[model samples]
Target chain A: MKSNKTNMKYDIIFFAVALIILVFLFLAYFFMTRSNGYICEIKKDNKIYGEYKMDKDHEIDIKENGKLVNAVVIKDHEVYMKEADCPDKLCEKMGKISRVGETIVCLPNKIVITIKGDKGSDSLDSMTK
Target chain B: MGVKSTKNIGITSLFLALALVLSYIETLLPVFIPIPGLKIGLPNLAIIIVLYLYDFKTASLINVMRIFIAGFMFGSAFSIVYSLSGAFLSMIIMTIMKKTKKFSIVTVSSAGGIFHNLGQIIMAAIVMENYYIFTYFPVLFVGGIITGIVIGIIARELLPRLRKIIGFEIKGSE
Candidate 1:
């Protein structure tokens, strides 16, 4: 019983320290990864489907064999999944992405939307134009 | 000696069966969280129990067999990859904590849970080739802690009762 008490004390200390470190890491990662993104690149089945400018508000319907599978919305310089036929609908609930390195993935549909800062002067000009 | 080995094998297989059933039950439950790979990790109960009752090698054998069997039964090839990574990582953390003997079973299990989620997240990042998937880390970390504590409590309660019935000494139980 005495040994158990000492074990409990150490366990609490260990848990508290681990909790603090993990919380710190979480906050640090969250803040460090936030940045302004310029383009939203959508990939289907690991292939680049299209890249859209974040400045424009538009809806993109991804189709497969004449059936709509997913609907992506870019509005107010942020992108989100508006609708999806996937079973889990996790992508739709993933909220918005407006920063570089942000991504929304639908594994069932094999669709990935990633936010990129800039490709290059030439590609950026062509995309904007 | 032969009889003892046979008894050990019997006990290990029983725990493996229990773990497999728990895995199947998990698949039947509806997705409560929107996170892709998040689960309550019910099968960890059997693995933890086996670890305390036997040794790390025995626990690892059961865990690997459970993941492969459960993965084939209810999941895809991709899921097998995720489970193997998560389970292996969690087991290693739990083993190290258990060896230290400074922490209780619940604390060890909680650590296992946190690392398990981390391992799966790492695998997700690799497969998707995007580091952004890690943004889900905070949520998974919290979830793992909660579920780990729950499973740990259950295992702690079950351990003493199991030892009484089986009439065997546990490795690291106080």
Candidate 2:
């Protein structure tokens, strides 16, 4: 009978609390880690493959387990997946990224390329408060 | 199995087919987020419906089957792994929430959505062997809330009408 009860008020209060908690968590994490210097961090097979300044354009070929899995290109303060051996090529299709939190992920190749800014905030950085 | 059980299977299959179509439609829509593993989760509607109608077991079956069928149809071999992890985790969380009877459909769905993303991120971390994947968590948490609310609202509106059409006794718990 309790399970069959449809108390609309209870639902509203419960979700409102849940939402507040999520928003709180998001804000806490966002403010704690916010940056905008454009640091490109690359990881392969769970290891730090390399870290490059976005301002310095270059290409990286990552080989894991004795196989060339992904090729990445960083140019013009932007990073993108240039080539991948995976079937979906979703990583390549992810397009160029310049923002602080954008990432290019190649699942099959076990590659994750993320853009993180250095220790300075841009004037337009909204999350900083 | 008896005739009644067979009938349940037949109806469940129909739900599976509908879930497959919804997932295919989702793939066709151009994803706004360039990030991989973010989806509007339209197929969640079917799972929610099955959950409210029958029980967790039926919902779980439909959830796993839909991932397999829809993955092959609209995604790659790799996507199948991601979705299976996501859908299974979402179903378990949602079922637990629903049984508690403390949360509304929307809240349950929102939680389900968030856990769905959590499941995928966990899988990605394992498959990619990278813990840095947690950095994407904040954005995905917000996305899950938004999409979960939408799916929950849709399921709430559809469930009553669907029950009438099927003419099944509204029994709570298995």
Candidate 3:
């Protein structure tokens, strides 16, 4: 019992320190990845559907055999699933996404919408425009 | 199998059912953030409880059965693969930590949660054929720790009382 108590104490210290480091890393990533420009990349069934400029306001309607299955809307540099035919509507409820590396996924429809930030050559215009 | 083993099987199946129901309820939660793959993993409570109350093999069986049943009931084929990998990895890690008897339940659970997320991320990278999926690691790690701590605390508080109530001699321990 006494040894277990000591083990608990040491374990608490270890987990506390680890949690602090994780929080630090999370905050650093959160702040560092907050670029203003992001590209909305859409994928359906693991295949690239389209890439859109966040700067442009447009709605993408994903159709299957001339039937609309999902709709993605990008306005004022934010992307969201505006509509989906899935029963749960989880993708629609994911809210707006503006950050790089953020994604909205509709599992039922197998649609994934992710935002990619400009990196390397800082080629924001070359790709989006 | 002996009578004792038969009893163990029944109890393990009960734990499996509990875990599956907990997982199902978790999906109904309206806590869908914009980030993908962030889940509170409520079923982890049942896994931890079984690990503490029973032996490693029983707990692992419950974990596997729970994942399979929950996947068939509430998840897609892709999700089944992701969850199977994550649950298996987390179970192995937690069982080892429990064997050490050097860490508290919360610490073990937190570690389990973190590894579970790591497993899912690896599977996601493989499935998507994109190494860039690793970019979600940090956020998922933080979320895993927070949720893991919560689960660990709950398990810690409940275990002693449950052991007393169940009135079964803990099958194995130091």
Q: All models: lDDT?
A: 0.83, 0.79, 0.79
Which 10 consecutive residues of model 2 chain B have the lowest summed lDDT?
Answer: B165-174
Per-model TM against the reference: 0.83, 0.77, 0.82
Writing each residue's lDDT as its tens digit, candidate 3 over B61-126 gives 777778778888887777888887888888899988889778888888988888898898788767
Candidate 1 lDDT, B1-174, residue by residue in tens: 121565677778888999999999888887777776778999999999988877789889989999999988887777888888999999999999999899899999888899999998888767766555676787788888889999999999999999887764333332
CAPRI verdict (incorrect, acceptable, medium, high) for model 3: acceptable
Encode model 1's per-residue lDDT on A1-129: one tens digit a residue. Answer: 999899999888978887897889777656645668888899887688899999999899999999999999999999999999976688888888888766788876778897877755222224323
Measured with C-alpha atoms, the lDDT of residue A3 in candidate 3 is: 87
Better candidate by DockQ, 1 or 3: 3
Q: Which ten residues in a row have the lowest lDDT in candidate 2 chain A?
A: A120-129
For model 2 the local lDDT of residue A45 reads 67
Best by lDDT: 1
**Rank list by TM-score:** 1, 3, 2
Off by over 4 Å in 3: A1-5, A117-129, B1-4, B32-34, B130-136, B165-174
What is the docking quality class of candidate 1?
Answer: acceptable
Q: Ranking by lDDT, best first?
A: 1, 2, 3
